[model samples]
Target: MNNEEKYKKNIHHIHDKSYKDLYSKREVALDLFKNISNANWSKDLKAEDLTLVNNTYITADYEEREADIVYKANINNSEVVFYILLEFQSSVDYTMPLRLLFYMCEIIKEYAVNAKHKKYDKNVKIPAIVPIVLYNGEQVWDVPNQFRKMIYNEELFGNNILNFEYDIFDISNDEKLNKDALIDLKNVTAAIFLLDQKMDAIEFLERIKVIALYFNSLSDAEIKAIKKWIKNTVVDPLAESAIKILEADKREVELMVARNAFILDEMRENAKKEGREEGIEEGRKEGRKEGRKEGIEKSKLEVVRNSINNGLNDDIICKIANVSLDLVKKIRQECEKN
Candidate 1:
């Protein structure tokens, strides 16, 4: 890839890495799962029972797809795969269900291969996969959650058609994510979600102050992780002006909050000044146009008056002065009265 493409890819990779690093923490992962709406199955499960599993899968087309997070957990005496798809795109993926299906099938195929199960082996027990998509996009996710919804004439096939519904956690949407419970639980993942939702740098910086309150409750390692994520995903992408103010005092979250209060007010004043300058520039352009138009009208009236004084006939004056015959007549009548 060229430098620009490589830069974009690296930026996207940074986002993926930051998210992977945060969720890989057992505490954060467990907290996310427990907060999933109608997820009573995970209520009885503990941290020890949840094992991180391989996420890279090769599809039938020989294309490799790496899932964000995958966990193996025994729920109700059955081995189940919890495939958490961390989606950070700004727009909704229309083929979300199909993407989930492809990943799930690959997971099952890998499971069968590892277990040494024959093609038609009835003795081999396939692990049930609970595919969950965690989206932090700006737009509301409008994609179909069920695989059957993507298939044509699915209703006609009835039970014969393969179908499964994936759970979606729109982290930006409070209705989808139990924000109150997660906040009450002091989950770091909730803080990440809340920060990710604020696209504006000022709003993001403001939210960091609220998130800082949880630092005392978190471990040093967790605090470090949050800082790293912010630097890589949030702060680095900001404009140089904002970055200067934010980086004024060692870039510490607590220190920055205190310094930024004054900085924010100054930034708002600068924005107002810029707006006023733009309005003045626009008004100057309008004024110039009006002046030019008025000058042309005055010149036209002068030509009509001169033609009248030259004793030129109406039709000749109309052609020479480029004024209408009616205007020539009006000028001549005015001269007679004077």
Candidate 2:
């Protein structure tokens, strides 16, 4: 099946547990929020607790309110607990905040009904819902990296109320972080960042050792199946789909590299041959122009001078000039003397 298909399969079991854990704890979300938290993700956040979390969660959940992943954690003296709902996606969802609010409402209704059905359970706390988005897409989905703009309203009179009800952490796929900084992020986050680099899809996926290792942790059967699919869909024949849309661009880049190498090789070969021919011609002409002894000497000097000016390094110039160290030194001395 395709990547989108696999994503929609509800095979949460296939997802990395650490990834799930990070989503629940908001470590990844918080890191991203430091850069991209917006107004939409914080609708129900009453005052302060929604902004931070550092405590033992009562329970982590995924089956709550039809969200992709949700976690119920206890913080704030372990008394005031809240829900941290996380959504993981390859593309952006425009209706996320509204959807999350509706989901929160549904969760409240469910709790109220459940209390009625229960034998003896205390009143439902109506815990706050915090939604975070982990977006991985080629282009940005939202306008601002943060979602603060969504909740604010500009009134006609003076400054209206400021509403930052929710928080969102959009790990921009296109944004490139340095290797050192990338290494510090959660391994999967780093893997996703690396995957966005320009490279062959097959090689790109292979280079992500963490992602591969995480998947490989699955059963042998699951690994075998994933390998087969990747081989066929990503690496084998159709594996070239990564650059399919950008075929011309890819070809142009390859051509540039090859073209440079070819031109350099041609220039070197031609220069070598030209140098030898020039040396021979000067040797002959000098022999004829000057007396035999001086002519031969001038020819040797000409060879040495031209080789030096050819841009070749000293070692290469010496080899091509075919002059001993002493002779080269003498030629240089003679030139300086003249």
Candidate 3:
């Protein structure tokens, strides 16, 4: 697979693993549910009250889709199920509301089928479903939260239109949950999402050290899974070098010091190389007396375009091309139009 696809796959894998690892435990799941849902009933519920449902609703047609998580629990003295859908794509999906609506319908249909097999009374109440979308993409989620919002000109239909709103936990924004209040695996998962958005190698490594403090409390298997995730999703060369240093040591604090030093050295080397290249390019441009300015501008634009095509971030492209951020953004916008 290409780098972009591999990156996305690794991210999804990490997310799936981390989520299941934490949510499978009743205590952690209860805390997470209470924090995210803010339901009055969750305040009095214990871990023993929750039960995981292993039913798979994904059909052959939807085989390409990731399996969503479901949990059956008793809340407020009533039976209910929670459907957790994860969206980690770089861009927002406008059809998410419709997709969730379809999934909820399938879940209810399955419940009905099972109820029939049990010979349930016609007056029996159906279990309520609470759907949640956990999104961690860099872009803001601007899609409609309610199914009715997806319908065109819903105002005309007024109260006749069907509607249900799903809860969203957007990790990109800090307004959702207080990360400091979370414990153990939940805190580490939040740190992972927060660190993923940081582009600086030093800052990322420093944050990783904070996450490592909780590693000693986790099982060996969990540690291995998290380490594997770091190796896969963190593709920055400087960050990779720091990870290598950190992995060599056992003590978290010592490893943090070692990683910081390694990152500094790597950053310096990269900066020196960039400077040398810039100097060489400048020398070459100066040699061409005719159309020198135009040639330089054309070369810079070409470099920006190539970097964008190669999936480089704006900061890196700006530094490499020795151009302003606005120029890089303009070129990216123009490229997108084409």
Candidate 4:
């Protein structure tokens, strides 16, 4: 795929309300801490300090902002708070550190504004403010996809040792994690990395299906919705895997989905949720809202074209896109017209 098409595939979440509950849930921090490397998260504030209260806040800031998920966690202890700010970049961000620095400084000024720093040394009494960059783009991350140089470099050459100030996790390419870690993390980890990398959609889908089957009891239409997203994402590279599992037991998936009445409950709840968000946001941004609806449809067609290229089953693409189930029946008509 070209750069433009690939960009949309990896980073469309900022515009999609379909993910409202995923990041907003209190469990997101836990999942990211568990799956992402070198992250040790605690619900108990396991530090040598305060009681923990998990919190979240998000903003469109679409008009002008550097983050999609802007939040603060109240890690209470000794009247000292750990202030954190977060940003999720589906594409390479050249100005990320500067943006993070800007936000971090605001937290400091905020501390001073509240008179919380009174009678305390401005140099010592301030709480720690952390800014994190969760990079999920497809580049090496040494530089932005558009630019080719480091923005600034303050050389600290002392005793023949060099110290670079930037700290980043260039988790692109195949080094993200092994299949064992993916399976151990179950669905959430699978979703995070699968979406991050240009992994085969079919393989991820089949894995998600099995995970869905295990928790087939746990996944509601949400898994099905995620499947729809997986299908919308790309051609089913693991189509054979899904078919092998399905053909092995015709009634297995049917029974599993049925046993979990949770899907139906979720469907109803989702309908209400979708209506509320769509009504408010969609009404305000009709052009973008309709553009997305149309874009997903077109992206689905692109995936079908990829399936035909890969020699996979083209029968399910339309059904999976969920734009119109009737599109499946009309595939021959659509395919032949061109």
Model 2, span 96-142: residue lDDT tens: 65555555566556556765745465553566666565554435667
Error of 2 at 188 (Å): 4.2
TM-score of predicted structure 1: 0.67
- Ten contiguous residues minimizing lDDT sum, candidate 1: 235-244
Give one digit per residue, the lDDT tens place, for model 1 in 1-338: 65445644555566666777777776667767785444766687776767777565535552322336677776555555444444334346787777777777877877778889777876757776777776765578888888998989888898888899877777676464544554565556666676666333445556566556553476656666666666666532232323443334434656666565456445444544554555555557777556455545555566556545533335444654566756776776688679
lDDT (tens digit, per residue) of candidate 4 on 53-138: 23323324432233334344444544546654545555576666555555556667766777555565656566665555555555
How many residue pairs clash in model 4?
Answer: 3
Which runs in model 1 stand beyond 4 Å of their true positions? Answer: 1-10, 58-67, 74-90, 118-123, 178-182, 214-216, 237-258, 274-338
Error of 1 at 227 (Å): 1.9
Please, what is the TM-score per model?
0.67, 0.38, 0.65, 0.51
**Which whole-number lDDT from 0 to 100 does residue 277 have in model 3?**
59
* Over 4 Å off, model 4: 1-21, 34-37, 40-66, 76-80, 119-124, 143-153, 156-174, 213-251, 254-338
When superposed on Cα atoms, how far off is each prediction in RMSD? 19.1, 21.3, 6.9, 14.9
TM-score of candidate 3 to 2 decimals: 0.65
- Cα lDDT for residue 332, candidate 4: 34
Model 4 whole-model lDDT (C-alpha atoms): 0.46
Ranking by lDDT: 1, 3, 4, 2
Best by TM-score: 1
**Model 3 regions more than 4 Å off:** 1-28, 59-62, 75-90, 117-122, 177-186, 213-232, 235-255, 261-265, 268-274, 277-338
